[model samples]
Target: SQQGEEDPQALSIQEGENATMNCSYKTSINNLQWYRQNSGRGLVHLILIRSNEREKHSGRLRVTLDTSKKSSSLLITASRAADTASYFCATPAIGGGSNYKLTFGKGTLLTVNP
Candidate 1:
């Protein structure tokens, strides 16, 4: 099975607040990544954490990966209305043919009120 399955389906938060999402996977992965896509915009890479890593931070984004539990979490701090978008977790599945395949979850739609 592919890795990274985000939950909550959707979220609503006020501007300047925080938003958090969780993800789980069934198989081992080399690294887990998060991405965001605003309305009519292309997907942008948010952050990535290696399998050996436990936590990582980039700007207001924080990511936590637990390999043993096979889960990950993404936390966005001081979110703004501009942050309103769909967030998805992706994991590069290992041993897949050409290895360029990326499995993405359905994603969690976050609505930030201004």
Candidate 2:
């Protein structure tokens, strides 16, 4: 079963504006990760926040996790048109041991217009 559900199905903003996206999950997870995908392309990992971590940051991206609520959020600072893409939240499958695969959310489509 898919674990995460992202909100605001889509967002549009001018360049230089910050964009925020959120995700809510159904079950306990070992870790939560964010990914970005350009149109007609595969996804690229953005950041990962473990269940034990409350917050993490990489470059202009910030991520926060709340295991108690089974939710997480990603914030992109100083956004640019190039940052436009579909962002998704993912978690490992519930079972499958070391061979588990990632289950992704529906994704939030972000459009940064110049």
Candidate 3:
């Protein structure tokens, strides 16, 4: 019930463009985190703002949280070709959960063109 589903499983953009991805989840959560995964590489933590945080920014990345709606969005500004990768959102499950671990979705694939 705590699956964070990301939309537009695939996305393509030119260099210097902006990329945005939306994530929705079922049930309640403790906190949500976004991570970036390059081909054949492990996911790198981008940013993590708790449910109480409405908005957070790190460098060119912006994250928004809406607990009431059980949704979130990520925006990457001035994207470069190197930004191409898969992005996923994760949430820690509560209520009948195990150690309150994080569960992630399939993720959205972004392809940035040079």
Candidate 4:
């Protein structure tokens, strides 16, 4: 079943500021991942954190997982206009037999103004 559910539905910030998005999920997950999508484009993988790990960082992005709470957060530092896009959190389905698949949240729309 689908798990991740992103918070704040939408966000707007000026360039150079920081942006933070959150996700909450139901049921246990082995790992959680974050992705970004530009308008009319496919999503890009940002970062992933395993259930065993508390936090991870990659470039300007930081991800944190709290499996005990079944929640995660993503932080983007030094946000730029190019960072304006939709962010999503994904988790693998609990059971899909041989057809393993990932389920994604509705996403948070981030608008970074120049």
Candidate 5:
């Protein structure tokens, strides 16, 4: 079953500002991954924070994980119109081959005004 769920179904922000989205899961995860989809394009891997890691960063993106709370958050700094897209949090499926399979959340749509 899908474990991750993202909050703030939609978000609007101005260019150059920061945007943050939160995700909460119902069960344990070895790692949580964040993905970005622009319009109709396929999902692009953003970042993955391991259970043992507290935070991770890639380019303008930052991800924080709290296993105790079964939640995670993604932060985008210095946002741009191109950054506007739907972001989804994913967790490994609970069972065999979990490492190869992922369950994604509904996603959080972000609109950055230029």
Candidate 6:
């Protein structure tokens, strides 16, 4: 089973500021992914970091993984009002051939004020 639970269920910040969210898992995972979902929209894959990787970056987003702690964090730099969305962390489901299945966290609701 894959279990990733995000912390600080909600956050509010102004545009141009930075936002950070954390996630913790219960079991070992091969990789972890972060996703964003706008209100009433499908999820957008943000980033994916493997167990062997400590950190990865994409544009204004940064993600770090610490397997020993079974946690990960997502950092959004220079936040924009358009960036307001719900962020979730996901991990692959257990069992071989289950890579297509993912378990996601409850998510963190981010509100970026313009």
Q: In model 6, which residue pairs have backbone atoms overlapping below 3 Å?
A: none
Error of 3 at 65 (Å): 0.6
Per-residue alpha-carbon lDDT of candidate 3 for residues 23-99, written as tens digits (9 for 90 to 100): 99987776899999999999999999887789999999999999999999999999998899999998876536345
True lDDT of residue 8, candidate 1: 96
Estimated TM-score per prediction?
0.91, 0.93, 0.93, 0.94, 0.94, 0.93
lDDT of 3 at 4: 86
lDDT of 1 by residue, 1-114 (tens): 556678899999999999999999988888999999998899999998999899999999999999999999999999989899999999876555765568899899999999
Residue-level lDDT of model 5, residues 1-114, one tens digit each, is 678999989999999999999999988889999999999899999999999999999999999999999999999999999999999999987667545579899999999999
Instruction: Please identify which of the two predictions, 2 or 6, would achieve the higher TM-score against the true structure.
Output: 2
- Specify the poorest-scoring 10-residue window by lDDT in model 6: 92-101
Clashes of each: 0, 0, 0, 0, 0, 0
Give the local distance difference test score of model 4.
Answer: 0.93
Candidate lDDT (C-alpha), each: 0.90, 0.94, 0.91, 0.93, 0.95, 0.95
List, residue by residue over 4-71, the lDDT tens digit for candidate 2: 99998999999999999999998888899999999999999999999889999999999999999999
What would you estimate as the lDDT of candidate 1?
0.90
Tens-digit lDDT string for candidate 6 (2-47): 4899988999999999999999998888999999999999999999
Give the per-residue lDDT digits (tens) of candidate 4, residues 1-114.
667899999999999999999999988889999999999999999898999999999999999999989999999999999999999999987565666579999999999999
Candidate 3 or 4, higher TM-score? 4
RMSD of 2: 1.6
Q: Which stretches of candidate 2 lie over 4 Å from their true place?
A: 95-99
By TM-score, the better pick of 2 and 5 is 5
lDDT, model 6: 0.95
